[model samples]
Target: MEFELWYLLLVPVLFGAGWFSRSFDIKEKKSVADETQTLYKGLDLLLDNKKDQALNSLVNLAKIDPDTVELHFALGTLYRKRGDYDRAVKIHNHLYNRADLSKKERARALFSLGQDYLKAGLWDRAEDSFRKTADLESDYKVRAIKELVNIYESEKEWLKAIDEAHILEKVTGETYPSRISHLYCELTLQCMFFKKFDEAAHYLQQAIHADPNNKRALIMQGTMLQKQGKLDEAVEVWKQVGKISPEYETLVVASVADTLLKAGKDADAVRYLESVAEKGINSDSVDAAVDWICKIEGPENALEFLRRYLSQKKSLIGFKRLTDLRLAQDPDNKELKELSDFLKNQIDKTVRYKCNKCGFVTKSFQWQCPGCRNWDSFAPVRSEDPSRI
Candidate 1:
């Protein structure tokens, strides 16, 4: 019995001795071989979609050799990509809580945890995780600030959003002037809604300072001035909008006209509106001009001006206005009635707005494109009568 067992052991021992020369150690080679085999088996299980088995193997390996930070990270990231967020969270959380982890490894784990929380829509948890990561001062600082900014915006915490946006601008060296202006504008609107006029005014000034060409701020400022019974000042402020962003004249037109009328300068208002119309902006400008003309010059002169303008330039809003005007007068005029009906149908057939970013056309104007989810991407453009484009 002893001789038989010795022969069995001798067979394996001789094979091992032959592979390990006199100068090399046999134990070190066997350890490496065992590690390689374990890794291959774990990878094969994972490839075969046996995630639970692969995880068990990795956990056992981790218990035996706690230094496999790379393997742990790979497994954690794979779990995240596979939508096993809870398991991913557990793995990353374990790594992050390890006192022996290197600073870089800890930061990576914390970032991964934050991303997992974000994916889970636990904004508060994600924010807390990211705040700790901020202390690590990793290269992910800018990315963390950007994520925090998004979180704050989503939560409607405008103050926090403003702070984060400033930090991101400093870190990334990329200007966010328009976005900063929008943040201030959001705060301003919030304040105004609560009748905190002083706070609203301060925020509006900050918004204009952040983006001098912010038409929304100009419009709000003009409205505030008009509400305070400073019609002249309001009109002057509204006029500034046209100088700064000629394309947004339509946005401030109604406000400017009302303020001018209140200030007893209807003629001056009419002149400005007509000037913008002559520049061939959106048809809304022509419609605004027509409104002023009807108010200041009587129906006959307004009709004649509109007819002459329509003969020179074509637009849906202009046509709509002309149709309404014609139908309002001489109701028995069959030719004018027929023309109004035709123009109304044509106007109804055209899309009124388009996304500048993706060229998505829609009938309603949206500040954000529903398709691409970009802010201020929608612009009013002339919709060709199918035959025209």
Candidate 2:
């Protein structure tokens, strides 16, 4: 009878424990459901382009569940995209320092932190983070190396950029010859600035080896040769550039003429200019040829040459040149001077080097587009549309 009484007393205690356990489970499930609802709300807000609200919701969720790695990544990326680099760095740095993060997650976090630093213009910190990230065996390794190349390029560390580019080429099993060639060309220019002719020539050779068709390298080679008193060799090298691309012939015409003039070959210079003009290449070349003709041949011959050239090409710039020549010959002609002024204004407003990728326009050529950060993106010919400018 005593044993039965003890068992009856224990049954109430057991039922009380069971009731508390069931209550705790219900609360835990409710908490999970609320977290899920918050996540969905955040996603909806993001999809609706309410990034501020979405960020708030995600911040709250992160506070509730700090272990959600993917959530932190999303929040960090959103912060970076929104130009909140400090917050983005904080979140990503926290994830990177976490002992519980897997190797891949740590790499991702470090890479993200690098991006934050880069966007914030903290080059040294970004370089450190990306270098460390590149050492890790993860998907971000190649990207980290690429960022390193960009950083070096931006900092004018041409040798370092070339090294990083080579590493990238090896990693991706593809050739970035053109990019590498440009980097070497940059190094060559640096060397040339210090009058290090020997080193400059070596770098030029490397540049050509990297990309034989690099026009900049060829142009630089010609300049270096000219500086070394090899006028004939320089002229020959400049001619090769025209063979590569006839449209690019204008770039070398002035150089060729100057070099020939230095060698007392005035007739040769005039002939070269005339040949370039007869091709009906572009406005700059035609204008150059007309100016040379006026100086060497005479105004009458220049007029005849320009009229025939304009008839063939019908260039606004050529027309402007013709107007200027006419205005010079008849100084008191009010209509001609007015027409010249109008054409000058129109050409100034319309002619620009436009980036093919981003439509960025500039008065001068740029190997890399400032707007889009793309190499070789500028059109070879000047754009004559005011709308593009």
Candidate 3:
């Protein structure tokens, strides 16, 4: 009778245990289903271009699964994309400092933290992070080196930038001749700033050797020659730019004209400038040629030259010059003054230097695009239509 009573008690105990196990399985499956549903909802929101909503949805999901490493990375990236660098740094820093993370995951977190620092203008921290990331054995090594190169360039550490650039070239199997050449030119300019002519010459040679087709280096060479009182040599060097790149010929026209004029070669200056204007009838070349013509000849002759040039090319700048001369000759003409004013407004609206890489427009020319950080991406010509750009 005691054995039968014990057996009955054991049966209730076993039944209770089975009931608890079944309940736990159902709850676990529900939790997993909720997580999956939230993930898919977030992805759908992202696909719908609702980034803010998607971010919110993922943030809630992350709250439930605090140990989700990839989810944290996604959150960090979203924060960075939204320009919330503080949160981005927080998320990635937490990930990077986690003791349980794999080496590759830690490397990725550090690289992302470096990017956040970079975008926040925290240069020292960014450099340190990237340096550490580069030391890690991971796929981010090349990217880390590239960031280091950018930082070095920004800080004017030309030697360091050159070294990193060489590493990038070797690793990527892609030559960075233009970028290296520009760095050398920067070194040359720095040397010249302190009147270190010999050092400047050496660096300039390095620049040319890095990229023989570097127009800025050639231009600087001419300027250096002119500074050394070698007018003929300067003129010769500047003229070579026209041969190498005719589109860039206008860049040297003013320098050539000034050098020739300094040497009492007024007629040669006029002839050379006129030829440049004839070759390229853009605003810069035309305005340059007209100014010199007005000084050497008379306003009437300049006006006459504009008339003929406008007949062939039909440039708005050339027409504006024509109206200006006409108004000067007869200042009382209201019609002419109004026409000039209208043209000036129109030119101001349209005239700008545009970057081909990023379509960044600026009033002045830049060697490197601020929008894309690309070198030599801006065409030398002034764009007359922003729409086309």
Which number leads on TM-score?
2
Which of 1 and 3 is the better model by lDDT? 3
lDDT of 2: 0.90
By TM-score, how accurate is candidate 1? 0.73
Please identify which of the two predictions, 1 or 2, would achieve the higher lDDT against the true structure.
2
Candidate 1, residues 148-201: lDDT per residue as tens digits?
887887788999989988988887799888778888998999998899989999
lDDT of 3 by residue, 182-239 (tens): 9999999899889898999999999999998899999999998999999999999889
Sort the predicted structures by TM-score, highest score first: 2, 3, 1
How accurate locally is residue 321 in candidate 2, as Cα lDDT from 0 to 100?
90
- Cα miss at 172, model 1 (Å)? 2.7
Stretches of model 1 off by over 4 angstroms after superposition: 1-13, 19-84, 98-102, 298-300, 303-313, 330-352, 355-376, 380-389
lDDT of 3: 0.89
For candidate 3, the TM-score is: 0.90
Worst 10 residues of 2 by lDDT: 380-389
> Can you give the TM-score per candidate against the true fold?
0.73, 0.91, 0.90
lDDT of 1: 0.79
